[model samples]
Target: MNDDVTCISCPLGCRIHVEKKGDRITVVGHMCKKGEEYAIQEVKDPRRVLTTTVKIEGGRQCLLPVRSEKQIPKDLVKKCVIELSKIGIKAPIKCGDLVYKNILETGANIIATRDVESVEKK
Candidate 1:
């Protein structure tokens, strides 16, 4: 199978072509080593940092911005969001506060991205 992937490892955003045949893989069209590495890993196992909003109670806003502590499997992103959608947290929440730990057993914690003051505090 041959695939073209845009490398995000650097600012250049090199268009990388990856070819997989049985047990062998070849990467081309990368301008740097990081691009090459990204292409290989992207083809084998793609990962992405998850960023989304969750329900927040009694806060300045009805939603709280959150993100995965690290990149999780790309395939699990939707599942993680679905799980988070079912959760509701109370404010005031501080930035960097741990919202959810070991989310879906991906070893990535969902952390608050910004502070949300309680409505009563306002």
Candidate 2:
């Protein structure tokens, strides 16, 4: 099988051609080592950092921004989003605070991206 991939490891978006025969794989059109590695890994397993909003209770804002601390498997993104939707956090959250730990056992932490102050009651 032959596949074409664009390298995102650096500013140079190298269009790499990957050819897989049995267990052997050949990559071409990459200028750097990182590009070559990226092509191979992308073909095998792709990952991405998730950024989304979570429900916040008693905050100035209705929702709080959150993101995965590290990249997780692409396939689990939808499930993670669903899990986040079911959760509700309190107000007064600071940036970098842990929202969810070891999410789906992928070893990725969902952290708050911004500060949310608590709402004062009259």
Candidate 3:
């Protein structure tokens, strides 16, 4: 089963035609090196990085920057985002701090992409 997909690998956004017969696959309409690999992997397995905010204490509001340590399953991104929304982080966070451990069992943790300092109250 093959499907056509537009390549977002670059600004060109080339329209790709993919055909699969038995175990073989063919593709066309790619204009860059990134798109060729993208088409091959798209026909194989598609993955995307997850980025979202998590609850933080002592910040301007109550949220901190968070992201997956590595790209998890693309299908799992929504589930992960839902779960991440439930996470609450205490303030004075460090960059690269482990925010959530073994999230989705991807052997990856949601980490603090930036430090959120405690807001001094007047």
Candidate 4:
């Protein structure tokens, strides 16, 4: 099968052409080494860094922004989101605090993107 994938490794967004035959794959049309590598991996196994918010209790905001520390397998993205949805954190949460460790055995921790201070009762 032949496919075209836009490389997102850098701002260039090179349109990479990929050809797959049985067990072999070839990628072309990339202007940089990183783009070439990205295209090749994208064809083999695509990955993405998951970013979303989880509920936060007793915080200034109702949700705490969280992100995966590393790019996760594309197939595991949904599962990761679902797991995150089922959990909530208590403030005071600091930026980079561990939200979930080794999430879904992906060896990536879900971390807070910003600080969440505890709300004071009047």
Candidate 5:
């Protein structure tokens, strides 16, 4: 069987044809250097930047924008987001604060990308 795909390296998406025959592979259709490399790497392993919000304690909203420092497995993004949604961080959270560490053991922990001041009750 052959799995032909495309490389979205730049504005010009190059159509790539990846033929895999039980560990043997062949790639074609590359416009640039990155296109070919991207196609091959994607076929072996695909990744995407993880961006989502976790719960917050003293913020007006229950969540804040947080992202993994680096791109992780695309499949894990959804699972990470769902897990973050259930978390609640305390107030006075500074940017770069560790909201949750060792999340999913992806070596990428959920952090506070924005600063939140603790609301003082009147």
Candidate 6:
């Protein structure tokens, strides 16, 4: 199988061509080592940092912005979001607070991106 991948490892976006045959792989068109590494890993296993909003109770906003501390498997992004959607957290939440830990056993923690102050009680 032959595939083209755009390298996102640096400012220069090199279009890398990768060819996989049985157990052998060949990469071309990369300008740097980072690009080459990116192409290889992208083809083998892709990962991405997840960022989304979740339900927040008694806060300045109706939703709290959250993100994974590290990149998780790209395939599990949707599942992570679906799980988060079912959770509602109470404020006040500080930035960098741990919202969820080891999400889906991907070794990535969901953390609050911004502070959410608690609303005054009536």
Best by lDDT: 1
* True-vs-predicted CA distance for residue 82, candidate 2, Å: 0.7
Instruction: List, residue by residue over 1-122, the lDDT tens digit for candidate 6.
Output: 99999988887889999999999999999998888888998999988889999999999889999999998999999999999999999999999999998999999999999999988832
Off by over 4 Å in 6: 9-12, 20-26
Give me the overall lDDT of model 4: 0.92
Alpha-carbon runs more than 4 Å astray in model 2: 9-12, 21-25, 31-34
The model with the greatest TM-score is 4
Model 3 alpha-carbon drift over 4 Å, by segment: 120-122
The pairs that clash in candidate 6 are none
* Model 1: per-residue Cα lDDT at residue 115: 99
Clashing pairs in 2: none
Clashes by residue pair, model 1: none
Show model 5 residue runs off by greater than 4 Å. Answer: 8-12, 19-27, 31-34, 120-122
Ranking, lDDT, top scorer first:
1, 6, 2, 4, 3, 5
Model 1, position 86, has a per-residue lDDT of 96
> Model 5 RMSD to the real structure?
3.4
Error of 1 at 116 (Å): 0.7
Candidate 3 vs 5: which has more TM-score: 3
Cα lDDT over the full model 5: 0.77
Model 5 agreement with the true structure over 29-82: per-residue lDDT tens digits:
887778877877787888766888776777655677787876678799899889
| All-Cα superposition RMSD per candidate | 2.1, 2.6, 2.4, 2.3, 3.4, 2.7
TM-score of each: 0.84, 0.82, 0.80, 0.86, 0.69, 0.82
Between candidates 4 and 6, which one is better according to TM-score? Answer: 4
List of clashing residue pairs for candidate 5? none
Worst 10 residues of 6 by lDDT: 113-122
Worst 10 residues of 5 by lDDT: 113-122
